[model samples]
Target: MMEREARRTPPELQELTEQLSLRWFGRPFIHEAVYNPRLRTTGGRYMLRDHSIQVNPAVEMMYGEEELIGVLKHELCHYHLHLEGRGYKHGDSDFRELLRKTGSPRFCKPLQAEQQRTVRHYRCADCGRQYERRRRVDTSRYRCGKCRGKLQEVQ
Candidate 1:
């Protein structure tokens, strides 16, 4: 995977976060920015507990620096706003204004890992109801929601 090929050192991410914070927000980033491989969809996350940021390594490896920077900016918005005791979440007016002012993305682009998912189809034996799911469903342990009928996989 690209995530394995182009892994960034923690210091590099931290430095970038600090630089962007200072340049744009006019404040120092006192917390850490570490790569977390377990992040599946979102590019980065700001921890409320320690005021730290966790970035997905796959973002830099798969997309590049521009995408990484956008993620950083988004997370930094959360960090700085939270520190200032302002609205920091996506739905907040302060967060929205900050994103627009900084030209930061409101949301991260969907990850490639999520695009190639295969949908599994199933049908209820008695009701003829159909269902689609991202994962395989065990018929023995599950039933159709509508009519409480046995579900059978449909090819």
Candidate 2:
């Protein structure tokens, strides 16, 4: 039973989204909500063509139910505004106003995995100058700008 309850089924997620729509937006959600595991950088998104809400399953797994609810609310704001032919884009006044009125987050918190990314630190062999990069820098090809010294990976 633990495995069965490990994740919310698609139907349960759909129901939850619908309920949030009614409670927060004062309107019933007629669209679908599904888990999109491919979402790496975002917590959730509202699809304009299909009017569906795609949630990153990792949001709930890493941040808990409250955070998941916040993501849902953010997506719902976009959904309702777009359907009503109002300004739904992030930069629009209508979108910002609705977000403020509903207390929905303008942006979701960064995922733990994203926050904990390994940054490669490099040091100049001669000058001892330091550099940090998200991707590995080839020590053989790259040299330090300060003293034109050989770059070496640190730690």
For residues 13-123, could you state the per-residue lDDT of candidate 1 as single tens digits?
Answer: 889899999999999999899999899988999999999999988888887888899999999999999999999999999999999999999888788888879999999
- Pick the TM-score winner: 1
Tens digits of per-residue lDDT for model 2, 132-151: 99999989998999889999
TM-score between model 2 and native: 0.82
lDDT of 2 at 151: 97
Location of the lowest summed lDDT over 10 successive residues in candidate 1: 1-10
Give all candidate RMSDs, comma-separated.
Answer: 1.9, 3.4
List the global CA lDDT of all models. 0.91, 0.90
Model 1, residue 68: distance off in Å is 0.2
Model 2 stretches astray by more than 4 angstroms: 1-7, 145-149
Model 1 segments more than 4 A misplaced = 1-4
Residue pairs clashing, model 1: none
